[model samples]
Target: MKLFVKDLTVIDSSVLDYSRGIIGQSWLVDIVLHGDLNEQSMILDFGIVKKLIKSTVDELVDHKLIVPAHAKFCDVMSDGAFTYVDAWREHGESIHLACPDQAFALIPTEQITLASLETYLTEQLMLRLPNNVKQLDVKLREEKIDGAEYCYSHGLRKHLGNCQRIAHGHRSTIEILRNDERDSALELSWAERWKDIYLAEHCDMVSGSELSLSRAGMAALTPEHYCFKYQAPQGEFQLAIGKSIVEIMPTETTVENIAQYIADTLAKDCSDALTVFAYEGVGKGAIASA
Candidate 1:
């Protein structure tokens, strides 16, 4: 027998890429189970699939930084409670992160792709599934957007949950309105500005001497990089990313603040009012007007 669920949940995360540095992403999940019928004449209850399967997948990867441990330019270490990662591009541009252990999913692969993640997740799900379940299939895919979208990585020290992790991020879309009229040009421009970027807080900036990275992480730094460190409720977090890939924000990087910032920026040169709809990921976001 086979049981399946589509649109299981969305995993919003940042992945360390050998060439692109840290890239944010959001993937919708679909799951299938191949198993014999249980005593209730069912493969698995729909409620259980939604609750158990969804929760498990979320706990494994949602709001975390996915690291390709086997990548040539990637290095990972742990001090039991926290994990430190150093990932670099071929030309030496790099990103470093130190956060609580729960903030990362160190997949055993050379690259973090849909195929790799699907295989990794399937193996993990099988271990926790019931005895009747003989096999599991997991599919991950990105949301289809007709308009402008971008990938960005950021941290919220004020968040009490997994969002506090310094390296987690999202793939987001932007909508701009000038005098209540849709402005596709403005949307595309902003998306281009933030492509594969890191949204950082000005307050989080720190000197290289004050960074909490490993020796190799510090060695990978160049003059063109910006370093940031902060202490959240979870633990001390640190990062070093190339300056060209970072956007320093005067305020927090929350979707509410992002929308307001866009509205305020557009308001400067506008003779009329403007509105901005900023999406953090799929289906949910914030709106602001000026």
Candidate 2:
């Protein structure tokens, strides 16, 4: 990690003011090195890095009573510096209006020191980005990994922390439908792979499910055996005698309604009555979009 800086580049303050209300308005100047991605580093996780930059910049602007241009200035150093540092002064107000190269005027210069900035910003971002961020070339490195790996906004994964993949994963925001214990049976209307399942009779005692039905058997049964009217016979039932671990001790035959039982059982396994409802809601919402 290395640093370089310059004065602010805002030629017009009115335009900046007009853009202030953007909820998550943020800006970063990526300092790219003439190099390639670190092969051994896997993917750069920008989740925490962005957070740290935000907090650090906020501290500089809001808390420290510094300006945005200045805030942006100091954030570069948070990523740490190696050799040469450059700042592309944004044509506006900055911490130090004039660099030593331009003119050698030495005074406090009305600019605040960045002593406490690093501690706070590093701490905030350390919670999310890779370790030793203080040593990385952040301005260039951080933005490149935005959709690569470790998106804190979403859960973590490799090659899939990307925005495209994130959209493919479960989204936390859709409206969840409300349901109850009474919704025991539902249409096994989706894929054959996802069958209508029921909560085990002794759900609390079961690790997951003692019943294991392969896609072949499930394919054989499906909407037919799972129909609300179908009933299991009076004798013992075995889904796969060929398999070593077979489903044992079948339930009462009066439990003729397999569909309702499956829906209700799925509800209990979720550990909440409305869980299946919420899950189904999300699934349907996804399909609607598709």
Predicted model with the maximum lDDT: 1
Query: Under the 3 Å rule for N, CA and C atoms, how many clashes does model 2 have?
Result: 30
Task: Locate the minimum summed-lDDT window of 10 residues in model 2.
Answer: 8-17
Give the alpha-carbon lDDT of every model: 0.89, 0.22
lDDT for residue 69 in candidate 2, whole number 0-100: 29
For 12-75, candidate 2 gives per-residue lDDT tens digits of: 0000111121011112323211222345552343443345554444333321112222333322
What tens-digit string does per-residue lDDT give for candidate 1 at 1-290? 89999999999999989878788999999998999999999999999988988888888989989999898888899999879898868767778887889889999999999999999999888888899989898999999998999999999988898888888888988889888899999899889998999998899999988987888887777789899988998888898988988999899889999889888987887778788999998888999999
Candidate 2 local distance difference test against the native: 0.22
Error of 2 at 126 (Å): 8.1
Off by over 4 Å in 2: 1-28, 31-43, 62-64, 67-130, 137-290
- TM-score, per-candidate, Cα-based: 0.97, 0.17
